[model samples]
Target: MPALPSFATFYPLNHHHSQGACQCGSPILSQFHERMMADISRRQFIGGAAGVMAMFAGLRAPRVLSQQPSDHNRPILLKNLRLFDGSGGPLREGVAIRIEDGRIQALLANGADSGNAEVVDCGGRVVMPGLIDAHWHTTLAGISQFEAMTADPGYVHLVAAKEAERTLMRGVTSVRDVGGPSFALKRAIDQGIVNGPRVFPAGAMISQTSGHGDFRMRHEVPRSADSPLSEQEKQGVAVIADGEAEVLRRTREQLMLGASQIKLMAGGGVASTYDPLDSTQFTERELRAAVDAAEDWGTYVAVHVYTPRGIQRSLRAGVKSIEHGQLADKESVRMMAGEGAWWSLQPFLQDEDSNVYPDAERQESQRMVAEGTVRAYEMAQHFDVKTAWGTDILFSPRNTQNQLRHLAKLTRFYDSLTTLAMATGRNGELLAMSGLRSTYQGKLGIIEPDALADLLVVDGSPEQGLDFLNDPKANLRLIMKGGRVYKNTL
Candidate 1:
């Protein structure tokens, strides 16, 4: 029989598993087994393993592509199209857009100019800004909670990468990732290693002990001052920080890690076991500390809260965005409007996309949120608050397919035009609140002169209602991001 390989060959020493390095039972291990059977010396096998590890590391690192050079001097003109422009204005016809160097060079009349530019006849389709999701969770959206907690980080990231492509195919070209370890995914997407949205990443969700983001088990709690951070925190999913000083430190840490905005758990959540839905978390001072730290970095803080008191406390702390205020009363809505805060609301009406909770209490919490969702929308509109739309799909890869369906649900409350504008234009405005820390520099969410070239060619018009959006594969004929065409069936 062939000599069995050492255990070290199966589990490489010094491998950063937390950063998603390959492990035993992965394809790499199969290769290792094959090589060992080939009777290679242990030293040679170890050297090959090291090479494989180096290759995986390179995949994680950002690379500047010579093929995708920045200087795209040659322009691409998209002609013969109707435009939505993402401004919620009437659609314009008989216009062409000039794209170059990942930005819109100008808007021109049909057959206006020809300077050796490549021409793409859009066949009179409706060209509009790509959709933006204001409250996405990049790493957590596609996997179940059990998998997210138990699976290897590398495996989880692989799942996320696959889901990212699906998300882009849905015509959602940009997303504000509110939580989870999305730094690697963002980097991969930006470097062109993966095809996905332009991610505005908030590195991790910060929560007080037993608060919304606290994912620790009961046995792991009741700790000392210097307890090792929970597995979730170590993986950059969520960190439990108490008091003002710790809150400030954690906030700054995320900012240092390239957080475009900070996300603080300002209240209890239905998903968390220990926290009640009605409970408010984080003192005003603690919330303020995070806000101050984020503001110092020229960005802002968005809080996760639903209860009236929680919303009020977050508003008082200078939070710029409220992730979920479905349970907010009229007073809270009025306060949000007065403060000019962005209300990132979702359609959580116990629909097919709703997350399934195991217990009755959590189910009740979900029901309460669903009940308040309609009222919340009414209040936001009544108060003229700056409301944005997002599908907060979490822990269910199957439900991600309903992303466009979630957007379509908005039509129940508003007109088709208003729904499209909210998902595209208004959400873009909310993303701009990230300020200087924003990853993509050019203006997004509008098809205007000099805006970033993130657009889609839709086969239907808003007059047909947003029902066409429900089936993106058949409706979205072309998709472009950063002047690069990712999908073009036409």
Candidate 2:
């Protein structure tokens, strides 16, 4: 009977031995190719099954509701509900959850446990992980004020308290505070003295003297018909370090200050007043020095880069990730991928109201910084680059909410669930956090036997249609972060 399992009969063997090599076990082209072939096959099948015609809006609602049961969370049990497990897959229905001590004890089929409990009854709402904003600016005062407070601990901590409120209320549970605003805020959040997102902070940015983060400007003041960095121009945020020795020292300094990671201005910026976006500000030695320090400190360095030369420099220097990447040419994009450095994309969508600030005032030299950002996003997508969402919020009034809404835009048509995974399981992975995998201390993003009870309940089934997330302030019925209900319309 077992004449021997054929090679084709074993899916794993076939995928590995015949298909191709991929870091992820799946065949590199399998998904794209499979979808293409399926589309063709469906077209042929549709012609034969001709009676199937179009339906009106909300056609999927009946299917969704039929599976939902009222009074589901009897003892905090999520009633009949749809589930997105955050593993880059489609949604499931009729799932029930049991939560206690802020930990998710179990995830099972609808009515899996009818035992007596104080269930909230999901009523079949959509449940997924709490959001994570990696590139949040916790210390926001305004672009005009950041430089002045670089050494002012009091001002930095004060700003942190205010932004913390803005971040958590909008559903961002965890944040990676990269560059500026200091690490004290992250520490305070961990200590519970402040109420805000869980922070993974990079104390202050490290940069070359003339680089984009460098706040220094040339002395030739007045008006410049041709020159950009006039002598009278203000200093950039980048710390001016001339040689490799100074760069190395600075990197260590950043680590000693409690940097979970490092942010280096490897190139110029589109927004910095001191340097142009295309300028190759840091040399390889300077960058390598920082990388060396980061390696020694057991952390990664995120480089703010926008030029081909600068990209190459950071890549060779072993910067762990590329931020912005707006001006990166084809070769640079390839180079970033080749090095396996992650791309932290900031999807900051600016309306005319946001970009009204003129050059040298609210300050960025370009007519608008939005163009380069959008272009970078397109290229990053084209190359299939592994990306994480970043806010780069700065001191904007919308605060961190702008970034959360931007994620809704990325999957406007379909698969918005992937964005949630990028914000959670994947983000934790990027930071080399293993035990916390798929968990908010065992409750939030992932479904497991023992996980936290931090869950979100939205109005519609996300898989059927994603417009539900389009309105963050609209139609959300329940939100439980760390088993504490901040919002519940149920």
Candidate 3:
């Protein structure tokens, strides 16, 4: 392998203008300069870079949340709760949780004294770790296929903001956005400028030419040095890169932009017009390039794949997560289990509203993948593979509204407890696979001391009735994320 170039050289920081001014042209450099001038801390600089990138991309700039950390530092105490600690088991009764500085300080026994914290009487309400979606697309939220293809960039960001708030209010505290431009949204939420889940962004989906990430219209020519990029690429949602070198460079770009993980299109997909559902996309070498780049940054590559051939190639290339393995065979599933890679599966219902593809062929491919959902789950379970649930709800605003309902669909394969765990604890584990590239520190998806304070208080025990998750707005009495109360209806 060739020596990898530094990120600064890969993405030049300075652009010399005709007037002889050496201006820091890129968003990354401008953010770095601003941080230096403002004397911002390292953590704030990292998050502010994302907000700067969003501003450069034509979206409204997000306010930096570092200056107001005190706003979220207030101590909180919940008394008399039935706790589901995100570990699979019966709920513990009459427990109390004490939160301070955005971390859980203690899990006290019933009737514990609250000290100076703001106490809320739970009245035996069920408290659990906030929900997590291992696979999500924050940039694509609340937009239909038609709108995504034609909507203005500003309008799309506005829609994404609204969707982020909705996702949080529904009890989901975190999401690993597998594809799309989510860096801005992630920064906004982290800074408290937006009410939303913690986001682990995969800046853009890297794809082989004509692969799943290729949202080019039929009339548009294939991407080349002289040709302009597609709108999606321009928006930082996805990029078309081929071969080892290009793939490596694109992966590095996303890593530089603060991607927790890299998403690669390793196979054909239903929504893309050019690729067949069963066809493998990227070559093994190309996949390896992506993995190598991600590993260099202490993260991993996750591939969008559905078929056995694609799965086998990605697994062999050291991909850490496999998305949409609906068409994966038993052998591929076993291989994934042997490697301990995650199967980020989505429960696709045939009766549900699907992405509106331009042509009949694309729609047919969508149905084919949807029909294979059951077989994929069965294979994963048979092999005891690590599984995570997500509502890969894309390009359909109506379907996006059913994010929790999609998690509920997991009950078809596993029991209610197991299903709930998949969405919370197991998904949290998957997000942590980003390793050092992860943004937020401390444990998530569990009600334990030293864990990040993302809790949801439900009116009833979701362990016994997972359906309570389906109607989170009604059943959720309180929602706290990172020690800040976003909703309290008790």
Candidate 4:
């Protein structure tokens, strides 16, 4: 007879088990088998055995690209680039940038050595920080107001996801979503389940009854504590809170849900049917309540106000950002500058499609707001008020797709470099005003040592002419966010 196979070879047991299991039918072998079986659950033992077999058979687990870590830890050296560091000055030529571990490690002069890193020749292309949108509505992107009010939430979210991807591909790596159901989307992007920009979600825009955030139809009654919340309020896109107490509670609720900041309708809006553009919405006490709540949570409040009185009241209540100050006068602009508040202005093109309102009064209100855009920009600049640029593309799928075009329109008021700086460096500074409540850390919107690696390598210099931004697909040669390359045509 052939020699009996050893227990180690037959069963592939460890040394201790092998010593006592030479004979299969022996008492020692039986006891060893029982003990080994007891040491591991049946399911685990089976799975482990199968895995070992698969390994021996040259089988491997399927790879999930999104779940896998990105090239964040890898070192990359971009050489021979015209670097626009977002410092509001001339671009540096023949510079090299080294990125490692999701941060800019160094900026080198011409012919400087970068050892053992993956080198990319930029071919004298323009390198700048990824753009930032100070104000955006992520969940409302690509959806008309009517569609948003009538469409299913699932369908709306799908559309928002597609738009988010489009926004990122256009070189906008970060956005401050002032209103919408952005918390879930932000998590999805951060977890690598989706590809999009880093979102600073404001949770919901807190408004007074019939204010800008109230999307209720005419038949719908004013919201009360006893009444069921509207779909928009329930989804955390907007909340209608009436007195000071309600305002404080709603603001706190938003903060509880991870709102980076608070948004309040301090004045009437052009799109809202019940309020005139000049009508003040929230009372001073109510506005102060929201501001207090946000401040307690280490954040600040941004208010939608176009009129001088509305802007002045919000400023007195400690609102840090004043959005849509189109109807503001020079005195109001000076007051905003004195208060050190940011004027988040949108350049509404006169020839663009106007916002549709069922009420004739609301349509007139829209036109009035549109007519004040130029004056708003000029006044803000004249007063030396800190200003941030945003598209404010709400309720129009067509307009949402033209985000970069809207940014380019700022060139009418500023030079190309100044316009670019507003969208990148200046806007980034304003976004960080949330302080401890900010979602992202590390400096952004600039290509400097220790800043987050959100960069764009454009085919042409935007500082020379912002026309390159109009066609991002062809002009944006490379896009990298957090050291992960999203687009690389080169």
Q: Compute each candidate's TM-score over C-alphas.
A: 0.86, 0.70, 0.83, 0.83
- Estimate, for each residue in 233-266, the C-alpha lDDT of model 4 and write its tens digit: 6546567888999999999987887888888877
Better of 2 and 4 by TM-score: 4
Q: Of the pair 1 and 4, which is ahead by TM-score?
A: 1
Off by over 4 Å in 2: 1-76, 100-102, 114-118, 141-159, 216-240, 348-353, 359-369, 399-401, 412-415, 433-445, 449-454, 464-467
Q: Report, for every candidate in turn, its global Cα lDDT versus the true structure.
A: 0.76, 0.55, 0.73, 0.72
Estimate, for each residue in 150-175, the C-alpha lDDT of model 2 and write its tens digit: 32322333444655755665567677
lDDT of 3 by residue, 1-490 (tens): 2332221211111111000010111122222323322432342355555433343354343432222223454588899888888887778886789999889999887778888787878887888899998877675556654564454434556677777888888889998887756776787677766678899988778988777766565567644588876544554656889889999989998998888999988877654446766779899999999998898888999988878999999999999999878888889999999999999887765555444445676557656776778788988899999999877665457766677888777778888878888877788888888888887988889889999999988886666667777677788888888887778777
Candidates ranked, most accurate by lDDT first: 1, 3, 4, 2
Best of the two (2, 4) by lDDT:
4
Q: Candidate 1, which segments miss by more than 4 Å at Cα? A: 1-73, 145-153
Q: After superposition, how far is residue 180 of candidate 4 from its true place, in Å?
A: 2.1
Report how far off residue 81 is in candidate 3 (Å).
0.9
Candidate 1 lDDT, tens digit per residue, 47-133?
A: 665533432343342232112322356788889999999988889998999998889999999887857677878999999999999
For each candidate in turn, give its C-alpha RMSD to the true structure in angstroms.
Answer: 8.0, 21.6, 9.9, 18.2
- Candidate 4 lands at a TM-score of 0.83
What lDDT is reached at residue 304 by model 4? 76
